[model samples]
Target: MASKDSIEMDQELAKRLFTEGATVVLLDVPKGTDFGIDIKSWNTGENFKGIKMIPPGFHYVHYSAVDEFGDIAPRVGFIHWFSKSEFLVKRWDPKEEELSSEPVPEEIVQRLKDNLMNLDRYLGPYPYDTWKQWQELTNRIDSTIIERCAPVCGYIRSALELENCDDKSRPRGAETSRKRKRGACLSDEQKEQELLPDLKPKAGTELRLTELPNLHYPEGSTPAEITKHSLDSSYTLDLLLSKLKQPIEIIGELQLAYVCFLAGQSLDAFEHWKLLVSLICRADSAISVRRLIYIEFLRTLEAQLALIPEEVLYDIVASNNFVYHNLRRLFANIESNSEVDARLKSEAVRMRDRISTKFVWDFSNLQEEEDDEAPVVVSLDAE
Candidate 1:
């Protein structure tokens, strides 16, 4: 079924990639250990040394240590921007059972380069099938965003890095409750003892994400103004945008959070992604003011929604989820607002229809439901 020209073009592209793409020379990794770059993953074989023919740009390299019993540890990964024909070397630490932190000597790296042909058989080709999707997901992201958002440890872990809490790090007023029913059997020492310090995440393990502004109304607002701002988050959105160097960086952050969640399995990234979505969707007035942002937001959101598993989009018991509610609100706001740019409005409508068709979600009654119920106010104040 292949045309001669098309087949020839494919061959030519493959040849170019093979000759010009980057290489990562990982050494001494266990045969059964999990190894991956970007979206593709595989168990390392006995002869596996590293990956080759990686198309130049950003890539996330991740792996999990496996035990003899076949139990796997939490996944850990780092993002790196590769250059064409660049050769990088890393070695496994047998004692630590992970990649060594020490840098490879230049002389040794040169020697490996000298013997590169002999090592070619052990290298795996990069997975090309998911490459396009990965690029779309990360198009807005770049080196600056990566440096700002990545964890200080320079890697992401699926599991939180927790450590035992010291006395100084313990919470104040953490004593055991004294209240008890009369005649209840209790240990006197247990009742008097202060609660133990809770384990906490290691300092450098946390991602340096941009902090989201509070969703509540600004200080000194009248009751009516508070209610209005609460119904629409455009004011809060402006405040958040003011902190960013460019409005487009918000999209970059959104992309970064998504890759961290999808590839690194970070729940923290998932939470951040949800917060960003909520903020963007609630900003009704922002659609007209930031038309470019809304356009990119819709495009990015559509791509992300397609990749998300169906189970995450809806809940059988709950009927609908956070994404459903927020998206419905967004569509209702865009449809009702006359001030929104025609182009942005059209894109919003197209996205709404696509989502409705794909997910079988009915947006027809969203405006009616919105009118019937009071707008949900997300208060930052604690009770």
Candidate 2:
């Protein structure tokens, strides 16, 4: 029967994957811990070890610890570039309730490998359904981009790690006076505790993302030029590109930020992703000059937008957020710029049409809207 043939084919594919794919050995994680790769997630069982048969390339591995009361800790994750048939071993630290910072010993890794067959039942197969989509989203990212942008601590956390601020870093003046008045009647021990420094995000936990150029106009620009640059951020885009070895790297960073936010749930990555989107969408002149970059940008943005959950999309579009505003500006610029390549302009139009149909946005009134906000020059005669 045809059904039997399909089952056999699937079985063969599974065997191939099991024989050729990489493996990750996670040791001693607690039951009910949340674990996931790419877009798939599940709570772990007592017998859970890690993932196996992972396709070779970039993948995100994330997890969150669950407490006795069923509360989940903030998510933490890392990106890994797997080689075919590679083996990676990691262990949990009960004290820290996280993956151990220290590397697994080579002897232990070898022992695990020697007994991998016995442990196979404890491992989960990589979720294959979304693998192709994940590949497309991360096609531009590589090891170099990961090393450049990932935090020094090697973990992307949904919540920033906080530490007590030193006296020098604590607020002074009015804030100090207000705190004093509030704590005036407290016991000495309580007052000492109140005076203790507030907690702040720990150093070294920040992603080393490329610095974005300032939005201000260049110093030597005339008034008219400043106004023009304000409307079209092509000059700022050029400055940002100049700092990179290649313009495409911007797309890589964009992909990295998006992945961190999507998989690790890091808000910092979300903000960086938004900023990058704003920069790209506002570069009106760059569409013509950097035709290839614009083409790739459109492709990347289209894929990312398609994957965004509807609820998130609602939040982004409902408030006329940065994405909606900048995309409108980008489309308008593409429509008016005669120098843009025909193919690029056609692509932009198609994207615009798709966005309009999907989001019920009206792009036809852009000209009228721009005219309404046009700057007025007042002329005054000296008396």
Candidate 3:
């Protein structure tokens, strides 16, 4: 009789075959390109065909085309949901620098399926090593969220395009907002707008979550206190929390977005991160809620900051101005009470100091009312 581990491995292999899985056959891809699905990466060789036994669901396929001189094209990727037993195929177009797919003749697909054993050497196996991470990243992305957040184009890929679309705020103009001035402070109206509910994100672009407005005030700030300040639905964290009845759903979405962003290089994930930051910062959630979740948020942010490549990190910080701005705002409100709060505050301060010391960018002057157009560079002479 086989040992327990051997028996388990054999059982797993047999179960994988019986359970529905998908196959991808990529043809004519450049020999030196790096291709990946989910968390598994493969360097293409002469006989490279595709990946096999893909567990059927959503997966991100990405590639970096390389040239003889070691130059790399901007990485491009797409997300696809493979049906059970799906046999998808694609052919690479060198001129277009993209993969193109069409309906494969049934006979050809049948032949490939029958000869899978012969082609096994060319097909890479599903990466069990990275499956757990991928699962954690994707498990919370339910069908409803997927349907809501998917770009209108019916295909998911990375490329920023400017088109004639209605201005979200004005609804009448075709203007795309430009970068802010060096020292711009948001007006009272602008500050309030941040708390307004953003129910539907624009279509034909990367998917992003809506920032549900906060409606609840802390115990001390009653209706009269809020009314005196002319606080509208915009400052209603209670309302936002009510809308998000299942807070775990939101947290899971954040984790999924972050993991996809870091591991799969999904630009869509970056957009999602921005949405999450906007929600958390502007919601002005109760102190208890903030205390409970701030550490997790801080830890996640630190992990991302530590792991991201320097070049990419700079680009992200520069392009996504809300990143540090919102983080600073989040940290500013932590009233430093219990031991947990103190520890979280320490971590937050450490992160701020690290960025200031290493990057010469100071978060000390970050104001909640100001739009962070760019980092404040501190000169050595000024110190």
Candidate 4:
């Protein structure tokens, strides 16, 4: 049995090895330590860390078992000890043996024997007959000791995971809950089909030309008479709020948010809609149809808030990460996001800084505010 240090060395080497069977090592070079390539990993146990991709023993190296003298570390002139005992080199050439020579020295013979032991005993090409024994042996040291496994998990594989029923697990009694609410589902769908927002706003909802006395939605429409046009009964505020509580389709919730925005109920709509999203997502970050819809909703809100006036951007900023990272990007998209016109954003930043500073002292709830009322109207003209 190997001593503690030898076992430790094996463990250390296994930890540093990459999936592709590559390892970084410093080799003895004439100039300095040179990086070696094709250093294969003999341990095939599974590891969650290090390089990905399994490797074979046939990979290139500077030296074979029983031969050591070579231009392995010309760069550093010594192996950069990545782990215990194991060494790596890209280029290897054995020292020339004399044609006429005396018997091998005891020290020289011992060194060759040690090298042979390292190869044949530790990491050698074994026969199929001993495959099970080898597997059992490696299993004692590590888990991912297989010779052919790949590491590949990113947005790409994560996207394709939808086919594997990863998203279909149902909560206990979910079928019963759906059955109980069956009648409500049809009405919700019907409502969505009827009031789906027309792709584009047509001659927008009438407003008091004076109340919004500055810019108009259309690029060139100038401000006209100041008469107040009470919002049409067809677009009741109550209906908009009701729609938010039940997002039959993403469009309805989005429309509700927009109308609330236009009606100067920015905070009410922001909280209602955002809370609906939070409820849909809850604590689960897994992908689902609901999560996809929520993501789309976030994208839409981000695009619209970009048009908010620079001077009043403070109202949109929030201490919540979900609110801030996404919502701030919405504002940041505007041409007015620059330091020249983003005094409100600057103020928001200061507020956030203060919030982080204060967190050290208090560990209570950290929402910006709980009230649904829109606190301060940005006087766009004041700027």
Candidate 5:
């Protein structure tokens, strides 16, 4: 019944879809169920079949399987990278109320292909509204990082499986106990546990952030070097400045970790944050550098705090002591008026007060203020 040109255009569209677009066929997903691919959602009806014309890249598929009784299962999600013309399929199990691994037979795939025109009516296009936001969130994460951090199981779930609810509250395991019983000598694992406030091991479905190694000093560094740069003093300032100059790619990893934890509820992101704060706060550089670094640190923290979601702010405040303490130290350092540069002093005061007013936190100290002009800032080149 169609005109010749109309039929040719349809054929061309089909060819394009087959060559470039990815397909996700959800078998037996119930009518009226909530389903989402990437950032878009739909309440699927009986007419719904699946999604077509999805771009080739990493995507999140989330669904809340509904039952006839109206009870809803926990929302589940996973990350998958689609290839060109990929035909991926998943089947929903009514009994389990979850997706099962039952493979779609080859014959069924062929049948679907043959009926592609008819099925096209039921397939929805990918969501574009949130795609821009998703790009901003993932821009820094490269293929290497993705390959390193992704779960071996190929997907992540929103909720982790908790074990031994009646016993120890720690969901990670009894490894900490065994470590303590063994001895007080700290290995990397032990050090990491100490640093993290909520050091629980990730369970089912949770996206894990890439693990970052502990900070180490350069080779052949002396004891005096260690003593000179004790974490509490000015040496810490130098460390912060050096780290601030790190490449954008590495910085992107931190941003990726942050956004993932914020948006994806990844525990791995939480861990990464702990390390980042520790590195920034534990440096003990000299006085001049310390003053400069405090300004930089204040700017960085304020930016991060402003951008962080309100829901996650409480977790951040409660989890870490380093940032808070260091901030207070910065405020105290400014109040001391140790430096001769009046402009630097004024800006430091302004930064401290601005954060204090915004967060409603008293960053001031109870200890007596250091004398104004305690000493002149020494030259960096001076011996």
Candidate 6:
């Protein structure tokens, strides 16, 4: 009654279906291959009331355990098509990519193909071109599972276009978020470090600003004030987090940028750099303002205490991908080659020494020194 290949396909499908958040599994998984998916929620756990809800699910059907191998995020949902006789696996990224096609593991691909064909009996039509395309590409690669019996030739050409619309409607969903917020602002008090009990922990802990001994900040130094309580070599890094909470709306914030720079957190710095870019957009004041920020940003990167590498720092900040963010002709340093070289280097060295002396090295001026070298240069040569 069963072709051996079809029977095997059915078993593997059963395993995936049962293990994937299935509370009431009607089918059983075979021995070996375990769950067939190592799907992790990658979340701590779920938070919901008794009405009952499924976790944002994941399927761990990794193409290879090695890095850079395959599409690993679990398909949020599965659907069957009768017309094309295929099954569709959907992920969140809006654009469908061709990369996942090549590196998929043999067993999983075969499993998906066989399961898709069977869906025709129970489900309705699927697009022909998309199905065919998937087949043509996969067929070139053989399934080694038992000499690869029957390869379904797909007449479809479209790459798999599956998206979970449900997830897109969730609160944090990017596409719908702007429409919902209506430029009002993030509603959660957590945005302002003012969330209630259930949310307080999840909002992420407020980090203590590390005080680097030498760094100084002007008044209204709340970010810097927090840094006051910190231990050694810690430049207060509050501004980076604050910007994410709410934009400064001015010509960005030099204090925030400098803080991020001193902390050597590139991701945080880049994000704040964006806020400064926004300020550039509003640069209704002066073109020089934006250039000043860029210059200062570069100066921070060049400081001796900086952890970010010059090449990477350049790639991230210098890429004009963020050009529109510049209003005050942001990178004057790049244009005025001589001026930038002189000014930026001088400031960088000065700041580097200051940061180093206050944090790592400290000394007092003392005239007690070896005078032999100075005398040799001063008296005999001059005379």
Measured by TM-score, the strongest candidate is 1
- Candidate 6 per-residue lDDT over residues 319-382, each given as its tens digit: 7424222321323223333434455445534644564464342222222222431222223344
Worst 10-residue lDDT window, candidate 3: 173-182
Give the Å shift of residue 378 in candidate 3: 27
Worst 10 residues of 6 by lDDT: 44-53
RMSD to the hidden true structure, all candidates: 5.4, 6.3, 9.9, 25.4, 10.9, 24.0
Per-model TM-score versus the true fold: 0.86, 0.85, 0.58, 0.20, 0.55, 0.21
Candidates sorted by lDDT, best first: 2, 1, 3, 5, 4, 6
RMSD of 3: 9.9
**Per-residue accuracy of model 5 over 37-128 as CA lDDT, tens digit each:** 75567788897888888767766677777778877655665566678878877778888776775777888887887787888788887765
Q: By descending TM-score, how would the candidates be arranged?
A: 1, 2, 3, 5, 6, 4
Measured with C-alpha atoms, the lDDT of residue 35 in candidate 3 is 83
Model 5: what TM-score? Answer: 0.55
Residue-level lDDT of model 1, residues 1-383, one tens digit each, is 98999899978978988899999999899999999999889999999999998999888999999999999998988888888899999989989888886888999899999998998899999998889898888888878888888888877888988887665674454322334324567577655543544576798887788887754678999877998887888898888888888889999899889888878888889899988999999889888888888888899989898787556555421644677778888888888899987887789889989988987877887677754346665676689
Candidate 2: tens digits of C-alpha lDDT, residues 1-383: 56988889979978988998999999999999999998788999999999999998889999999999999999988888888899999999999999987999999999999999999999999998888889878988888888788888888889998897655675343244355657349778866866666775687787888888755478899878887887778898899889888888999889889888888888889899998898888878788898888888888888888788777788896766557677788887888888987898899889988988977877787655555346576445567
TM-score of 2: 0.85
lDDT at residue 351 of model 4 (Cα atoms): 42
Q: lDDT tens digits, residues 1-383, model 4?
A: 89999889856744544222333221122222222222222322122111221132222122212213433311111111133223332222224220111233556545543564343332322122333332221211111211111112100010111221111343222243235445654577755744542231112211111111122122443332111111111112223334333333433444334433332323434455555443332222122223334344444443444444443345444433454443333223222324223443444345444544643223123333334412333344755
Considering summed lDDT, which 10 consecutive residues are worst modelled in model 4? 150-159
Model 6 spans > 4 angstroms off: 1-201, 204-266, 281-284, 287-308, 317-328, 331-383
lDDT of 6 at 298: 41
Error of 6 at 267 (Å): 2.3
Residue pairs that clash (backbone atoms under 3 angstroms), model 3: 214-236, 214-237, 215-236, 215-237, 215-238, 216-236, 216-237, 216-238
* 2 versus 3: better TM-score goes to: 2
1 against 2, candidate with superior lDDT: 2
